[model samples]
Target: MTAITEALRRLPKVELHCHVEGTMRPSTVVELASKNEIELPTSDPTQLYRYTSLDTFLEIFWLVQSVLGDGDDWARLAYESAVDGAEHGLVYRESFFTPARHLDAGQDLGDIVAGLAEGCVAAEEATGVRIMLIADIDRAYGPGPGLEMVQRLVELRRANAPGTDRVLGIGLDSTELGVDPTDFAPAFELAGRSGLRRTSHQGEVTPPTTIRAGVDVLGCERIDHGLSLLDDPELTQRFVDERIPLTVCPNSNIRIANAYPRLELHPYARMRELGLLATLNTDDPALTDLDLTYEYRSVMDAFGYTWDDMVTIALDGVEGSWLDPTDAGALRARITADADQLASSLATG
Candidate 1:
């Protein structure tokens, strides 16, 4: 490997947009399906993730969700995701979990949180990679169920549950095409009142107005897949001025045909040029067949980013994270020190 690729791999990183369900190992999915007697479109693990469209991918995504029958499955998935992330240089992660799906499947919220918390605590102890949860409101289920999910989360917090304590926020995910961000305002408001942070998926396939609604109506603190922000100069300027962080998944966008069809045309580089606090992520590492290291290398090659530019993006991930000020500051300092040392070594070597 070149010095740049090696350095990127060694660099400490943070991921704020990964999905826990989407990170399930392919072998684990096959095993879980067998154990649960769940039928899948394909029994072959290699063939399970092949998808030509977003709709097809969601079909598989839900199929994987079906295999997770109880708290143990959720806990195992959480633990494995952290282990896999640590192998990829992850220092911290905030993963999105769709509780609505599990609840619809007859899983209890408390059990789900307990299981995930167990996995997170063990993973943190073993790998020193801090993992937090973001309970996602499935937009396809509409507003009432979304509101109920947030209320349940509030109740869990009130009870001082183990797993719920790590759930720092609420995120809107799944099938954003027909859904309006405004529809979930009441739920997000409840989350705000309950002391939960807010974020949502917008601008991947939707227009800039959806992003506006997420921020203005839903009070989103960060935006996921916000590629369409480039469409509105005024809105883009506001995001720049406000330093709203966007977690962009380049390969996922290309795979799903949402943004630019080619990696070279992706707006990630332009987003950085516009000073939009853009950070790279693997939205669904297992499904996308990518890791954070590959993302860093892809952007470097696509945008001709130097190691210093990579450092800037890495720091953006730290600053954009939901980590408390004290933890974020310490992480920033460590990353700054390590990155400088790497850059200095590269210069002299």
Candidate 2:
């Protein structure tokens, strides 16, 4: 690794778009598959991640999700995911866990949340990296199930069930094509009423109108993968004026969605230039063979961003996070202090 890349690796970073299941190690997948009695088409770790499109990627993502047969499996997955991210300088994260399939398979939501909480707490103690959960609604399952999931989540919170406290918000992901964001509005609304923060994956393959629906109809506090927002100048300006956060996963767009043929062609720089609150993240890090540090280095190299530019992006991550004022101030201070030290070391070295 280059000095810059190495330093970037050690720089404290926050991730908001990561999926916990997507962080499962390849070897862990093999073990989990065996434990769950699920058959794999291939045991080769390298070959496992090769995919041509988003749908193909989801097939693999779902396969990974299927491996968690119980709470213990989930705890293991969460623990390893957080630990791996911590190694890459992830100091704080709001990780997504979509349990629709697991729920449909007769697993209790409480068990899943409790298991994830147990694992994340362990990881926090070990790495000093804090993580909170966002329960995502799988759009492929349709609106009814989505609402049901949120209702159950509300019930868990009402009962003060284990791990519900760790779940700070709700989000909608998976299969955006041909699905209306408003269909899940009831779920998002209920979550809002229950004091859950909200966000949704929009514009990855859809248009700006869907992105608008995500914000207006669903009342999402943030938008994930709002790649198509620039397609509508008016909407883009609104996002800029409002400083709405877009959790952008540039490499994932290239590798999974095929939205752009290369990283250099991505609209990330354009988004920033327009003064939109676009934060860098790795949507499915392990699946795409990505980490936040490499993400920083690649964006810097691709867009000719200097260390200061990268630091700005890192700070934007803090601003875009779901952290409250006091906690956010503390995290921003930490990143600033660490960045100052790292920059001094780099200058000297």
What number of clashing residue pairs does each candidate have, in the order they appear?
0, 0
Question: What lDDT is reached at residue 206 by model 1?
Answer: 84
TM-score of each: 0.97, 0.99
Candidate 2 TM-score to native? 0.99
- Give candidate 1's error at residue 223 in angstroms: 0.9
Q: Candidate 1, residues 1-349: lDDT per residue as tens digits?
A: 7887878887899999999999999999999999899988788889888777877888778888889888888889999999998887888899999877778777888899899889899899999989999999989888998999999899989999878889999999989788878989999999999999999999888899999999999999999989899999999999999999998999889976555667899988899998899989999999878888898999899999988899888899988998989999999998899999888878887
**lDDT value for model 2:** 0.94
Evaluate all candidate structures by whole-model CA lDDT and list the values in order. 0.89, 0.94
On a 0 to 100 scale, what is the lDDT of residue 126 in model 1? 91
Q: Where in model 1 is the C-alpha error above 4 Å?
A: none
